[model samples]
Target: MDKIVQFVQKSEHNATAVAIFGAIGVAVVALKALSFLKVLVDVFLRSGINLKKYGAGRGGWA
Candidate 1:
């Protein structure tokens, strides 16, 4: 992390550009984490309609 900070500080890139790119990267990672959490909650905590009640294995559409 120190190396990264040094590189960014020493590079010729504009500060605003670096800040914008960093913010975009952070937003992407955060959104991905939130999406994964949502999937986990849906899979483990949420309940779905009972397919058996709709005759799922009897050839009728569930």
Candidate 2:
């Protein structure tokens, strides 16, 4: 246990930096995924889109 503690003490700075940046990266990815899921639910599912009329008017993108 003492050897493990000593090793951790030795690498404290590098460990702290890695942990902080890793947490930030994880938070950013989570926020992006949440944003994408919100758009999927709000725009794709909740909004009513008349596909046939839209495709007929807009020329073959159905």
Candidate 3:
């Protein structure tokens, strides 16, 4: 759409605003993924079983 293109052009011209918006977008996605992971961990913990048995291996990093 013309309006969408215009908006993108406008945003591109404003470096600070673009950076702020990009940071906000990344933060929102990170928070959502973390929340989902938390829920998954809670569910697995409640099941009283080791997730490793399901072929999930431990990472080398601490």
Which scores greater on lDDT, model 2 or model 3? 2
**Which stretch of 10 consecutive residues in model 2 shows the poorest summed lDDT?**
53-62
lDDT of 2 by residue, 1-62 (tens): 87756655788786687679889999999999999999899987896767676666666764
- Candidate 3, 3-62: lDDT as tens digits: 755676776666567678899999999999999999999988766778776666765333
Candidate 2 off by > 4 Å: 1-10, 48-62
All-Cα superposition RMSD per candidate: 3.6, 5.1, 11.7
State which candidate, 1 or 3, has the greater lDDT.
Answer: 1
Clashes of each: 0, 0, 0
Worst 10 residues of 1 by lDDT: 7-16
| TM-score of every candidate | 0.67, 0.57, 0.53
Query: In candidate 3, which residue pairs get closer than 3 Å at backbone N, Cα or C atoms, i.e. clash?
Result: none
With a 3 Å backbone cut-off (N, CA, C), the pairs that clash in candidate 1 are none
**lDDT of all predictions, in order shown?**
0.87, 0.81, 0.79
Per-residue lDDT tens digits for candidate 1, residues 1-62, read 88777877886675567889989999999999999999999999999888888788888863
Q: Considering summed lDDT, which 10 consecutive residues are worst modelled in model 3?
A: 53-62
